[model samples]
Target: MKGILKKVYVIFFISYFVFFTSWFPGLSFFNNSNKVELNDNVKLQAQAPDYWPTTGWRASSPESQGVSPQKLQEMEDYIVSENIGGYIDSLLIVRNGYLVYESYPSHIYDANIRHHIFSCTKVFTSTLIGVALEEGYISGLDDYVLDYFPNRTFDNMDYRKEAITIKDLLTMTSGIAWTDQVDYYQMAFSYNWVQYVLDQPMVHQPGEVWNYNTGGSHLLSAILDRETPNGTLDYAKTRIFDPLNITEYSWNLDRQGIPIGGTLLHLTPRDMAKFGFLYLNNGTWNGTQLIPASWVAEATTSFIDVEFDQSHGSGYGYQWWIYNWLNAYTARGSNQQYIVVIPDLNLVVVSTGNTEYQFIRLLVDFILPSAGFTPLNLVFVISLIVGTISLSILLGFTFFHFKKKRTIKKLRKEFFEETDSNGETFQ
Candidate 1:
């Protein structure tokens, strides 16, 4: 009986571990931390107009900000029905520079966990290049790419490769022979990324063709590595991330110590929205100009026309994706990670997910219509999500807590009773 009780205790602890670690039924008890908060979101929008969100995002309701709560609910429902929210870590919607909607699915993932944004890191590298220009680490985009690598010897050096400019790499028109399908993994495995990229033979003349070259992005990383004041990651901390108050983040490095520029940037969903907000505000945060407005314009504009996905996007900008939609851009990553900016709407929608679905179209379908179609009446309604957890969730947790305790108490009584009944206990 003593051994049996010990086994049962071990099982109880194991049950605790399993329930808290993964998303299982009733994990909401462990996941929910925020107490119920109720208020009108619109009344607080401009309480401090100069706010930069350096601390954290201020929560709001969609309806208070002229967004239809019902439609937002529809979008959330679609995400659940399609298993979209389950695939992603977080989904956030910001309108008029206010965070109106946010949802995190898995119990493990919360607002604080910094996620690997994957290819979305490409645009950040580009943004850093702009900072490099501002800080005078780089002279201009028209400068030769080879000039940044004077000491590194290239056996395959030629006029076409030498003609490659900072601009060339920015637009993926470096024309360097790179098949991202195969070369990306190869480059990640190799010890010397710069050499591997510089070694690739020039298949087309510089700025002649738009090829999806991951090598080109790695080259930008190498360039920043050499040219910037500190390493690229350190420079990012001071110039981009810190300025935006993105204090919690991790930039993964290659085996060679090169920070993966094309991908490998990690940020929380709210921090990612700050980046979009940075671009949306034309690189200004609060009153300071963090990135040049000119760079923001050039970086988001269609620099080249490349067809993709059978439907969206007219071309690629410096590191951003310029879609066919008016004044719209996105920083996209593999597995459907997106930080989408709609300049026309003054809106930013962010998601970090695993599935490859058009979250933007879903936005257009569900969220966008609610923003403009509804008339703005100043009446405030009680928010459905004002409480962090619903009454059912609360009751469920209470029931489960008491039930576990009662079961454990019953087990203890029964075990001792059975042991006493045996009359073989000498202790």
Candidate 2:
């Protein structure tokens, strides 16, 4: 009886560890996306023109942009309706260099707002690493993780700990035992977050297996801060945010004043779209290569097997969640904050809401089918706007002519009536 009870206890313990270590990834529980295929209508189209959004995004009708305008309206109706599982704060869609569709609740969130992005911040951290590598701030991804932190003391440092590389952290293969109980959640509250992260005992050899380690990500930020001239946040401000036109944003810092890269960033949905757009353009923004195209390719390419949702190439990028929809990859956060990029479709979809993972259904079920195959060119939009204005003017002139004729006819009738129903003029 004692032996049986001990075995059962061990099984229960292992089960709890498995369940608790991997935090809620905020995807639908019923996702069976690996076998799903792209809808025929959402097929890949020709390349979209390279248009820079310097000042602001240009607006156009969805239909004009090869996205069904009626479908967007219906999607908006659904967004506004109560059937939406949770509070959907905002949904902004950009396709072929135009802001074809956007929805927001004005009362809950301001028109220009930023909120907690949670784990999506990890992708931004990954971008900073790319910039660091491109600018020679970071030598390479294979460099030893501990080499950057010479001043810091790590407890129980071993051969595996020394073998951990920047890439290992980027890919979450550091083998650091960062589960729910012995993880970043507890480390965040500790007096020294960075030190606490460095002190974590290695559970597996470096580069052996992939496991989500928030502490390992924080170490990346710390390394960026150490290597960069202005520190991680400042480096990001000049390197990523300034170039991308992301003016309004804030990143949480630890007690050591180091930018917490693992989580706690507040960014607007549009700004999130800009980051996605930056990646979709392959590290280039307006022809200037902010991040090396090489790094972008490496970062976006599947480093390990991860099935986040139902679509092809559902693997983990540097920090991005590779989803199955339209072959999209995204910077996703808790509570449905996502900046999904569909390269083949030339689409960037940004959303922030309280509903967990239901937005995927919203996007795949409603948005894709409703979109058109062809790109919506800027020349067409300008011509359409001009045409609309010209048509409105013509209608205005026609209405004026009819109004003038009607007034004259009424006056003549009144005059004839006053003059005893014969030809006569009234005053």
Give a tens-digit lDDT track for model 1, residues 232-253: 9999898888878898899888
Clashing pairs in 2: 33-310, 66-372, 311-324
- How much is the lDDT of residue 332 in candidate 1? 84
How do the predictions measure up, each by TM-score? 0.74, 0.73
Q: Which candidate should be chosen as best, given TM-score against the real structure? A: 1
List model 2 lDDT by residue over 128-203, tens digit each.
9988887899999999998998877889789999999999999989988788445766897899887888798889
Top lDDT hit: 1
Report lDDT (Cα) of residue 38, candidate 2: 29
Candidate 1: worst-modelled 10 consecutive residues by lDDT:
374-383
Candidate 1 global lDDT: 0.75
